[model samples]
Target: MSVLQRLLFARPAAAYPTHVPLTGLQQGALTVLSALGALASPRRADLVAAVGETSAGPALAALRRRMTLDPRGADILAERPRVTDALLRRAAALPPDTFGGAYAAFMGTRGFSADERPPVRFVADAELAYIVTRAREVHDFWHVLFGCHTNVQGEVALKAVEFLQTGLPMTALAVVAGELRLPAEQRAELNRTYLPWALQAGAQAADLMCIPYEKHLEDNLDELRRRYRIIIAPATAGAAARAGSPTPPLGAAPPGFEGLGPGVEGGTAAQLHETSGRLGPV
Candidate 1:
């Protein structure tokens, strides 16, 4: 059997999987794909606008009825050519201490030390590729919106929601893989607290990827909560942190990433690892 398969099925005492290394070539490919995805999608800006228009139609219609009117969304609608490179560049220059910076560094700290995550060393071409990439970048905001910590149950809940919303295969993988981290009661709580909410919110709310998250960084969490009809499950915060227990300490400053301090406020530090091993970009 291959080393990875062994690592996958091996029993470890830590209650989570050990870190598995990836070869150099495999790493190179995913980076190329992420970059090419960022570049090749000449329609990226168009797709972003289109997704928002299509996905948010119902939400907008309802919003119009309940609230007087939102000229901001309409203004955004009037402006075509969504999310330009210039815009992304301006966004990058914004403080790294904010949520945006943490997202920018995902491929670095997020995947295994041995294998950098997407747009790192390889890339892929898929439908909704840019949308998928955007979803990955703002994953944490979803947590913040849900008032969730990085616990296994929360991750599973979000993944299940993503699966239902976008039908992304990777999200389904996350749902199944994340299940390994849950204890019996926590798993049950996941089913009760997060599952239905994820389905309803994911289906009902607008396509998050298309929404200009950067614009909302300073927006009141309460306002977002009210509009979306979401609940931050009060089941308890420790559940996710316990799952943070691991064998390999996350390596020192991840490469391909700028050192931004979460302490700096508005900047974020994101860490993504799993029981199976670190998630590689490839």
Candidate 2:
């Protein structure tokens, strides 16, 4: 075998059904090179996925263990549901106030495609591969839940939350690299406003991987956020407005949402406090 092949495929192929099995050195080199590529041009989703895949072994394993313990997450691992184009189309047809509807709007308004996210290639185990793929697919869902736009500020803020939630090294790198790309004032604004909110939200929210999003497509969006303890960052609301996709106002009780229950009208200060108290500590 050639030297490059030996380095890249040092391990036996039996363990990794979905990818080439690389040695530690090979994985590290790939991670560094891909990270540099992503840093130079954050729009390169391929490079970003490469960084995530090459650096994610330990983190993915930890996440898999956590998921195995949660009922919904465990079911998800067994069923292996994908965020397919058909699913997106179905979401697009739902009522505007529903979670799936909001996700459809977020993608349509920003011109993002469900197919844009690269598939997981480097993870060694089938389940871990699915975990990584699930994380990638649900990224836009995270955007809608947090009310974060697709701007640099919004992306960086969401990266902070992802890093905290998944312990993924690539997310931490993205947060740092993204911050460095911002101007002084924007960086300060991110730190002063979004970063704190992201940290708190990330730490307090439930295991998002546990959510069976497909089943909850019809659930009221605002109610979903409340149940999950997700507080949309104040800055995100304005950013969404500027992008001409103003967040559905809180406490909006348009007919159908009434069945979703009370507290949908407007998030009062007491309600916000109660949500925080319910989340308590991680």
Poorest 10 consecutive residues of model 1 by lDDT?
259-268
TM-score of each: 0.44, 0.78
Best by lDDT: 2
* Local distance difference test scores for all models: 0.40, 0.68
Expressed as tens digits, the lDDT of each residue in 67-113 for candidate 1 is: 22344534433342233334434534444434333333332343313
**In order, how many clashes per candidate?**
20, 3
Task: Evaluate model 2: give its TM-score.
Answer: 0.78
Deviation in angstroms for 166 in model 1?
1.5
* Model 2: per-residue Cα lDDT over 1-282, one tens digit each: 888777765774745455767675777788899778866755555666677777787888899999999999999999999887789899888887889888787767645567655556667677887887788778778777877645566666777888889898877876786667666877788788878888998998888889898998999887888899886766545544665654544322221211111211222211211111111000
Any idea how many clashes model 1 has? 20
